[model samples]
Target: MLKKVLIANRGEIACRIVRTGHRLGVATVAVYSDADRDALHVRLAGEAVHIGPSPAVESYLRSDRIIDAALRSGADAIHPGYGFLSENPDFAGAVAAAGLRFIGPPATAIRAMGLKDAAKALMEKAGVPVVPGYHGADQDPDFLLGEAGRIGFPVLVKARAGGGGKGMRRVETAAAFKEALASARREALAAFGDASCLIEKYIAHPRHIEIQVFGDDHGNVVHLFERDCSAQRRHQKVIEEAPAPGMPEAMRLAMGEAAVKAAQAIGYSGAGTIEFIADASEGLKADRFWFMEMNTRLQVEHPVTEAITGVDLVEWQLRVASGEPLPKRQEELSIDGWAFEARLYAEDAERGFLPATGMLAHLDLPDDLARVDSGVRAGDRISPYYDPMIAKIITHGPDRTAALSRLSDALAQVRAAGVTTNAAFLRRLTIQPDFAEGRPDTGLIDRHLTELTMVHAAPPEVAALAALSFSGTLAARKTNDPWALLSGFRLWSGASDFILLEHRGQPLPVSFLSKGEGNYRVLLEGRDVDLRISSSPDAFRVEVDGRTSTLHEVHDGKATTVFRDGESWHFTLADPLAGEDEAAAAGDRIVAPIPGLVKLLHVAPGAAVSRGEALAVMEAMKMELALPAPRDGRIAEVLVSQGEQVLEGAVLLTLEVEDG
Candidate 1:
């Protein structure tokens, strides 16, 4: 085995690699940018080195700096954990030329499958089934348009060099083809520095099924079953599971064999995934699947494979990189049970799933029933320079139904504040009728978005509890003094104290008259509730309407947050003595929701725009967000121009409401 391994990445994947390396008695080294100086991965590694500034181009993608750090730290091998430089064949070759082992596929294999166009050609020659598309190198707009017509409408114009859905767009008709092509190319050039693209026939109702393949230096390769990643948004995966639901023995064998063939065609070594887009309009069958693309490194969803097969993929990467043979043959590997992985991201699901950034005030995750892979703690900040994924919640059970149930329960038990999250949305998605029946497809989220994204108001009882916790009334009950016990208590006259709070832009008053003995009568919005409250180390038990429930609360002075049954609410304390000011009217101004660079200005000052028209485009966290005009009006002031970096709530422009 290698003596020491340097992880050339950051975040949860980096932390994951360090854990496995340490477990195998191999010292680990971590490289970080300026933003990740105090990151969890840096703290977990045996030795750490600062590479460059926070921008990924200056730090994480700097192969020279990463190579130097590895050599300086005496690392014998380098593990590029999926992203940044993981699939860059040039970087792999650079590391190998520096006398350091690259813990991934050989540079030739990476080059063979680096570009989608070239890789599909290679797969077609190797007799691996590929999707019908245009992979030719003619970049003229007219030529591409003709090809689109040939392939049929609803074609996907994808960047040949892109992943993570950055430079991809789906066109539904010929009328939208020109605009979609220009947009896709613009994003492609900005993201990958390559304006070239490929056109593919869009598969309706497709399921994203991928096979995990491993290879060793001894020219041996094997497949570790497959993962069903059909649940997706914005062309990115959300929930993934192993032993694809309703997968038959014959179909699994066919996909597994084709995956091994794709890997062997490139002489692939180490860990890689062969992703296939299956036409599930019918059902999963051997002939319905076609090759999509091959990821030439470890995957983010590898944990689900680990939970089901009892195999550590990182361990296999290390062993294979150290000149070892394949750990097990194809016949020896078999699935044990079922597993699920839900990606918890710091993104608001209600607001178009825009990424969020802030300091984590409190984070409480469930244990015992699930395994959490996280690179952040309670106090860490979610920076704007990186991906906003907080953690991967993994659950295992004896069957698919049991595993899905455990995953639903585990997501509910997670409590976090200070940054908006998709946890609530994830909880709703898990219980959807189609999802429960294992009938998820790539269009599942988009098709049922209205029902899945329903927003619920916080109950008045929850706000009352927050008020008690914030005012120290809940903690004072443990005191010995008689006066403290009766702090908020009133006599027979029935006097009540009003606690003012603001939630969802509305003022809520909670009136309470304590009866002592941890009992109180609370009135909120004209509704009365009789409750008894008690506190334990982990949660507060409240009995209301003859029903008792346990809840967790976190307060950060600015916002008091309460979590109950997989849902959360934030209430900001309102000043009772101060006079309230008139709220600002809507559609007056447009502001940025997150810090990002203005990529384009679609409207100039004094330019008239219709309601819901795209006014500007902002790039944040590597995703482009279109700032739409709130109403039919003219742009009053253009506060920002293209290429300017703006902070959250920084007004990009204002609109002068058009007279009716």
Candidate 2:
């Protein structure tokens, strides 16, 4: 066995590798960038080395630095845990040059499947089915336009070097073909440093299925079945499950055999996945699926496959890289149950899943029945420089239905503050009618976006608890006046003290009555509650309906008052007696959404555009978002240009819309 293994990655994946390393009795080494000095993965590993600066190019993507880290740590092998340098074939060669084992496929395998166009050619020769479209090398604009016409309308322009939907466009009309090609190429260049593209028939209502194929040094390869990852947003998977529901065994065997053959064709070793795009228009027939590219490393959703198959892919990777034979034969490998994996993101699902950044005030998850693989604990910061995925929640049971139920229960009880998240959104998706039926396709989320994206309404009991325990600057009045003490409390008679506070955008109030000084029974919601207060320093706790709510705030007489529920809620102790308003500013230029490189700016200044027109496109958080104009307008200013890296909220372009 390899004595020490260096993980060339960050976040949960690095942490995940360390976990298996410990189990296998292999010392794990972790390499981190400056931004990840205090990251969880660094602490989890047996040893850690600082690679370089935060920008991935300076650190994680630097093959030399990764090799140096492995050498310095005395690790016998390096595991490029997905993304960064996982699929970079040259990096594999560099690692080999350093005389260290790369715990993945040989360099040949990565190179073979590196580019979509090249891979399609190879797969076709290997007798694997490929999508019908243009995968030629002609990049001339006129040639691409001709190809689009040849392929017919409703074709997909995909980056020859792209994945995660970063550099892909589905052009539904001939008129939009040229624009889509330019946009796709720009993102392709920005994301993969390759502007080459391919055109394919866009299979409507497709199911994104990928097979988990594993191989050992002995030329033995077997597949662990398929994962239905059709539930996506912008070509990025949000939820994935194993043994795709309603999947025909004949199709499974065919796809599995193809995946194994594809791996063996390139002399593949270790854990890799072969992704296939299947046309589900007719409900998952055997003949409709075609090769969609391959992820040449352990996948993010590997745990779901592991849960159902009772196999540890990481252990297999380590075992294979250590010159071990196949752990199990093809006949021995079989699925036992169903599993589901939900990607927990630190994003506002309601706000178009906008990546959110903040301190994770509290992070606690349920037991392992709902296995959570997370990189950060409470008080960790969600950085803007990396993927916004906070954790992966995996569940397994006898069937898909039970697995989904466990996922729902696990999500609801996870309490988090300081940033908005998709926890509620995920919880809602679990109960969705279509989702419960296990018939998820790539467009499932988009079709039910409005319902799935709704923000959850706070429960009345939680609201009651929040209102009763109020805080803030207790008003500027009664600094020296005795009546100031009466502000939050009522007198001896049956009366009420109204307190106003703001939570989200709504105003809420709580009423209470005073029984005595420093110690009194306050009338709360038709019931008298015991309130103990220290006159010198005011502090109290209110227990109601079997729940305890803590109150923390300064009694500032009367002015601005702040209170805490799950988060802080502030109120004006004194009524403003008047309201405030501001003039509406024009909403222009679909903002850059997030910090990333500008892929394409579709409209120039002074150009006329229509409502819902594609104005620009940006690549961020490893996905591409096309910014569309909300109304007909004349392009006023394109604040950015292609290939420019920008910050979040920086204007990409502006438009002059006529206000009626």
Candidate 3:
């Protein structure tokens, strides 16, 4: 085994590698950029090296810096953990040239499968099933348009060099083809530095299934079954599970064999995944699946595979890299159970799932109920310089129903604040009819988007809890002083204390007359209710109108958040003395919703645009968002230029005022 290894990545994947390395008695070194100086991964490693600034281009993506850090730390091997330079063939070559072992596949294999267009061609030559598409090198827009027409409408324009849905778009018609192509190319170039693309026939009702394959340097390869990742949003995976639901035994065998063939064709080594796009409209069939692409390194959803197979993939990677033979033969491997993983992201589902950044004032996950893989702690900040994924919640059981039930319960128990999240959305998806019934497609979320992203108002009980926390009633319960208790008492009559709280811009007035002894009569919005409240170190017990329940609350000095039954509601103490400010109405200015670089400007000064017209495009968190005109108006002035980095709420342009 390698004595010392350097992790060439950050976040949860890096921290995950460190734990395994320690368990195996291998010293681990961590490299971090400026943004991750005090990150959890840096604090977990045996040695740490400072790479560069916050941006990935100047740090994690720099092969020279990573190689230097590995050599300087005396690490015998470097583990590229899933992202960054993990799939970069040049980086693999550089690591080997620096005399450090690359804990991944050979450079030759990575090169052979690095680009989707070229990889598809190679898979065809190897007799592996491939999707029908135009994989040629023709870059002419007119020619590509003709090809898309020939391939039929509803084709996918995908970046040739990278994955992760960075540079991918689905064109439904010829009229929308050119714009989608331009957007895909721009995103592809920005993300992978390669704008070249390939057109593929989009599977209308597709299910993303990938087989986990491992190979040793001694020409031995074996498959670890498969993972289903059909639950997606914006072309990115949201949930993943091992042993795809509704997978036929025959189809599974065929896919597993084809995956092994693809890996053997490239002389691959270490951990890799053979991703296939299945046309599930007609159920799972042997000939209905096609090879989509190959991920030449560990995947983000590898935990699900480990849970069911009872195998440590990272350990296998290290052993194979150390010149060991296959861990087990084909007959020796078998699935033990069902496993499910849900990606919990710091993003607002109500805002089109835009990535959010803020301090994690409070964070908690039910580790006892499930496996929680996270890189951030309470007080950690979610920066805009990288991905906004907070953690991954994984659960396993003897059967799919049992495992999925556990997953639902675990997601419901999550508690977080100070940043918007998709916890509620994920829980809703778990119970969604099609998903719960084991019939899921790539378009599942899209088909039920309205129900999935709907933000329901907080229940009256939740609002009452928030009000109690903000009123100091819950805090005062911890003390023994009678005078400190907020019991509205007087010499001759019972006095009522009134407090105002705001939720989602609406003010709620709450009045309470404490009845003493943990009992009170509360009035909120003209509805009267009796409450008895108590607290322990970890939770609060409240009785609302004679029904008892336990709840959790997090106070961040500025806002009070209440968590109940897998949903959260945030409230702020309203300043009754403050007056409302007179400000400009909406659409007066076009401001960025998040901090990002301006990718394009569709309109200049004095240009007229109607409501919902695309005015500008901003790139952030590896995704592009098109800014739309809020109303029919003419541009008065353009404040920012293309390629300029701007903060959230930065005005990009202004609309001229209407003539009275």
Candidate 4:
């Protein structure tokens, strides 16, 4: 067993690795950038080293800095905890050169599977089914266009060098091919430093099924079954589950064999996942699955595999790095139950799922059957310097239905504060009728986006709880006239207390009354709501019917109060009547919604435009959002230039409202 293992990454994965290392009596070392000094993973490690600055390119991706940190910490081996440098063959080679064991495959295997174009060709030669496409190296635009014509319309243009759908585009017609190809190539170059792309036939209503293959240095490998990652947004995996729902036995065996063979063809070892995109229009069939790509490191969704197989893949990685043989044989490995993993992102799902950032004023999660794998705690800031994935919520049970039920309950109980999150959206997805019935495909979210993302506003009763949670503020203000904040029936009647908050940037005022001491009644819009308070000075629990929400108060001798109730939360004003005219106007302008590079500017000074015309492009959180003209008007002035860094809501261009 390895005594000390250095985790070559940061965030929740680092914390996750430390836990398993501790369980096996192995010391864990953590490396962090300046941006992550206060991160949860750094505090959890047995030893720590600061690698470099905040930017990942200069820090986490620095192989030399990581190797030096490992040597200084006296770590016997290194675990590339997904992303960062996990699949970099040169980094693997350098680790071996520095006399440190890399807890992954040999450099040769990484090189073989590093490029998609080459990997697909290799899989084809190995007799594994590959999607029909043009993998040739001709970079002529017209040549590729002709290839697309031969492959039929609706071909997928994918970056040869990267994954995550970053440089991928789906073309439906020849007229859209050239523009898509150029855009895809540009994005591919920006993200992967390689503009080369491969065209593949697009599968309609595809189901993404991936096989988890584990190999050892002893030339042995076995499959840990498959995961169904059909639910997604913008081609990114959102919800993943093990032992794919409605999987045919014949298809499972065939996919497993193909995946294992692909791994063997590359002389792969350690933990790697082989992804296959299947045509689900006909349901999962043994012959319909085609090779997508191979991930050469531990995956973010690895927990689902562990949940069903009852195996600790991290421990297996450690054992294999120490020159051990396969721990288990193919026949010995089997799935026991169903498992689901829902990715909780700090994003506004209602607003194109734009990544959100703010301090986690309060965070809470239940631990019944759901397991939370996260890096941030309450009070931590969700920064734009990295990915906005807050956590992964995993649940397991005897079957898929049970796991899904567990997922829904757990998502509802998660209270995150200080930022907008997708908690409510995730909850809705779990309880979706089609999702509950195992009828989801990759296009499910897109097909029913309106239904899937209809934001679940706080219930009327929750609004009541929101009122009571902030009612304490009124008590402090009306100290002189205690009756001012107090509500009761003329000793038996009730008095209504008004509360104000901003939901989705719209000002909404709510009213609630004190039924009695500590108990309250709330009216939202025009509906009456009930609240049951069960709290002490430090915290309060408000229960309504069957749903319960916890509220934590923060008093800084001010008028603005934050009402934190799980990830689904908002701020409240201790005095709503006084904040009616605090809006910024004139010289003050609109700001960017989130931190990102300014991608495009649509107007200039003296330019006339109508309401809803494209204004500018602000690229944040990897997605581009168009800022539209707020009102029909002529441009008074352009406030910021393209490529300027502006804070959230900073005006890019100001418009002069036109005269009637």
Candidate 5:
């Protein structure tokens, strides 16, 4: 085995590689950008090296800098963990030429599958069933439009290079093809430096199923079953599972065989995944699936595969890189149980899943029933320069039911504060009736989005708990006054203590007739309720209407975030002395809701735009969001142009409201 290995990546994937290296007694080296200097992966590795600035182009994507760091740190092998330079053929060849082992496939294989158009052609030659698409070299917009017409309406325009839904779009009609193609090409160019694209027939009910394939230098390759990643949003996977819920043995065997063939055809080695889009409008069958593309490195969802197959994929990568044969043949590999993985991201699901950035003042996760693969600590900052993935929570059980149940429980117990997260949304998705029954497709999230993103404000019991917590603060403020020694003390009956709090931006007034000893008859919205409160350093126990419940609380002076039953509620104390201001009148101004780089501006000054028309496109957190016209107006001023970075609430355009 390689003695020392360098991980050329950041975040959880880097930490994951370091873990396997440590278990195998191989010292690990980590490379970090300026933003990740205090990142968790840096602290986990045995050796660390500084590469460049925070921008990925200056640091993580700098192949020369990565090679220099590997050599300086005495790393014998380099493991490009999934992103950055993982699939770059030039980087792989450079590492090999430098007398260092690249813990991935040969550079030739990477080049063969680097472009989707070329990879699809290669797969067809290898007798692997590929999706019906136009993979030619013609780049003329007019020619591409002709190809799209031939393929049929409701087609897909995808970037030939790179993944992660960066440059993929679904064109629903012929009229939208021209604009969609331009958008896709722009995104592709920004993301992969390639403006090439391919057109394919869009699958109406697609289920993303992929087989994990690994090979060794000794001409041995095997498959590790499959993972179902049907639940997605904007082409990004939200949840994934192994041993697909309703997979049959015959189809499973066929997919495994085809994936192995694809790997062996290119003399591929190390861990890779062959992703297929299955037409599940019927059911999963051997003939209903077609090859999409191959991920030339370890996947983010590999943990679920590990949980089911009892295989450490990273260890396999290392073993293969060390010139070893396949550890297990296809016949020997077996699925043990079912597993589920939920990607926990630092994002607000209610805000169109926009990524969030903040200091993690408090972080709590379940450890008993699930495995949390994370790269951020309690004090870590979720930076906008990188992906906002907080962790991957994986659960295993004897069957899908048990695994999903455990996953729901684990999500509920998560207590992450000081930043908005999708934890609550994930919990809701797990327990949704259709999701619990394993009947979901790529459209499941979007179909049930309204209900899934519904925010549940603090209940009366939770509000009482927040009130009690705030009372403690009031008591602390009077520590120097003997006259106000007892903040909760009441001398007469029916003497109400008034307090105000806000939940989900709504003011709530709470009044309680204190009877002393932490007991009170609280009145909220004119309804009287009896309550008892007890607090400890770890948790708060509140008895509401004769029912007792315990909650974990984190207060940052301004707001108190309470977690209960797998969801979090943030409450802020409303000051009675504060005056209410009139609502801002709707104006002819468009401001950015979040900080992002403007990718495109659809209009110039004096251009007339209709309501809900796309005005500009902004890219942030590796995702693209379009800013639309708030009302029908004519553009009067454009503050930010393409490729310019703007902060949150920065006005991008000023418009003159159209007269009636």
Candidate 6:
């Protein structure tokens, strides 16, 4: 086994590698950029090295800096954890040249499968089925347009270099092809440093399934079965599971065999995934799947595979890199149970899944009900410099129904505060009819987006709890002190109090009259609610209208959040002295929704634009967002130039004021 290894990554994957390295008695070294100086991964490793600045281009993506860090730390091997330079063939070669072991496949194999277009062509030559598309090298726009027409409408334009839904667009007609192509090319260049793309026939009602395969230097390879990732949004996988639901035995066997063949064809070693896109319009069939691409490194969803097979994929990678033979033969591997993994991101599902940045004031994930893999702790900030993934929740059981039930229960138990998250959205997906019935496609989320993203209004009880917290009633109850109670005394009746709170931009006035010990009559929005409330330091026992429940509440000075059954309702204390600013609320200025670089400016000063017309593009968190005109208007002035970085709410341009 390698004595010392350097993790050439950050975030959860880097922290994940460090744990395994420690368990195996191997010393680990972690490299971090300026933004991650105090990150959890840096504190977990035995040795640490500073790389560069916050941006990935000047730090994690720099092969020379990573190699130097590994050498300086005296690490015998370097583990490229999933992203960053994990799949870069040149980086792999560089590590080997520095006399350090690269804990991955040979550079030749990575080079062979690095580009989607070339990988598809190679798969075809190896007799593995591939999707029909134009994998040619012609860069002319007219030529690509002709190819898309020949392939038929509803074609997919995908970046040839990288994955993760970046630089990918589905064009439904020839009229939209040029714009989509341009957008895809620009995003592709920004992400992968390669602007080339390939056209593929979009498989309507498709299901994404990938096989986890491992190989050793001894020319032995074995498959760990399949993971179904059909639950997606914006062409990105949202939920993943092992031993695909509704997978036929024969079909599984065929896919497993094809996956092994793809690995053998490239002389590959270490951990890799063979992704396939299946036409599930007719249900899963043995002959309906085609090779999509090969990920030449560990995948983000490898835990589900590990849960079912009872194997540690990272350990396997380490052993194989240390010149060991395969741990188990193909026949020796078997699936033990069903597993599901839901990605919890720091994103607002109600706001078109926009990435959010904030300090995690309170973070709690259920450990007994499921496995929670995370790198950030309470007080950690979710910045815009890296992926917005907060954690991945994985659950396993003896059957699909049981496993899915556990997932739902686990999601209900999650509690996060101080940032918008998709925990509620993920829980909704778990119960989505088609998904719950084991019939999910890539378009499942889009088809049910309206219902899935619908923000549930906080109930009267929830609002009551927030009011109690805001008025210090809950805190006073915990102390059992008469003087601590802030309820104003009335000579004739009982102590009464009135507080104002805001929920979803609407002000709510709550009034309550204290009856006696732990009892009150609360009025909110003209509805009266009788409540008996008692509190401990961590939780409150509230009986509202004959229903009893326990709830957790947190007040961070500005807002109060009440959590119950994994769902949360946040309410801010409304100030009576503050008045609404109509000017700021009006749609006269275009502002950046999040901190990002201005990638393009579609309109200039005095340009007349229609409502919903794209005016500018902002790139942040590795995704491009096109800002549209809020109404029919003419541009008055452009405040920022392309390539300039702006903070959230920074005004980019203004619309001319028109007289009515």
Q: Which rank order by TM-score, best down to worst?
A: 6, 1, 3, 5, 4, 2
| Per-prediction tally of clashes | 0, 13, 0, 15, 1, 1
Deviation in Å, model 4, residue 549 alpha carbon:
9.9
lDDT of each: 0.89, 0.78, 0.90, 0.82, 0.88, 0.91
Give the candidate number with the greatest lDDT: 6
Residues 16-99, candidate 5: write the lDDT tens digits: 999999999999999999999999999999989999998788999999999999999899999999877999899999999999
Instruction: Return the clash pairs for model 6, or none.
Output: 412-566
Error of 3 at 605 (Å): 6.4
TM-score of each: 0.93, 0.81, 0.93, 0.88, 0.90, 0.94
List residue ranges in candidate 5 displaced over 4 A.
Answer: 139-153, 172-183, 473-485, 493-495, 574-592, 595-618, 627-660
Tens digits of per-residue lDDT for model 4 on 42-127?
99998899999876778999999999999999999899999889999999999999999999999999999999999999999998
Candidate 4 is scored at a TM of 0.88
lDDT tens per residue, model 3, 209-262 = 999999999999999999999998877899999889999999999999999999
In the range 1-660, model 6's lDDT, one tens digit per residue, is: 999999999888898899999999989999999988899999999989999998888999999999999998899999999888998899999999999999999899999998999999999998889988899899788999999999999999999998889899999999999999999999899888999999999999899999999999999999999999999988789999998988999999999999999999999999999999999888899999999999999999999999999998999999998999989999999999899999999988987999888789998888999998888988998877889999999999999889999999999888888988899899999998899999988999999999988878887778888988888777777775667764565688788888899886778999988887788899988899998887777888889878988888888878888988767788998778775465444588899998888999999899999999999999887677899999998999999999898988899999998776
What is the per-residue lDDT of model 2 for residues 217-318, given as tens digits with 9 covering 90 to 100?
A: 888999999999998888888889998988999899999989988888888898999999999878887888999898899999999999988998999999
Cα lDDT for residue 42, model 4?
A: 90
Give lDDT: candidate 4, residue 130. Answer: 97
Candidate 1 per-residue C-alpha lDDT over 1-660 given as tens digits, one digit per residue, 9 for 90 to 100:
999999999999999999999899999999999989999999999999999998898999999999999999999999999889999999999999999999999999999998999999999988899999999899898889999999998999999997889779999998898899999999889888998999999998799999999999888989999999999987889999998988888999999999999999999999999999999888888888999999999999999999989999999999999998988898888899899999999988877888998888888776766999999999999988889999999999999999999999999998889988889899899999999899989999988997777767777568888888777786676567777766655556654677788886678888887766677788888889889988887688889888888888887767888999888888898766654232233466889989878988998888988989998998877678898888887889999979898889899899885465
- Lowest lDDT sum, 10 consecutive residues, model 5, at 578-587
- Candidate 3 colliding pairs, count: 0
Residue pairs with backbone atoms closer than 3 Å in model 3 (clashes) = none
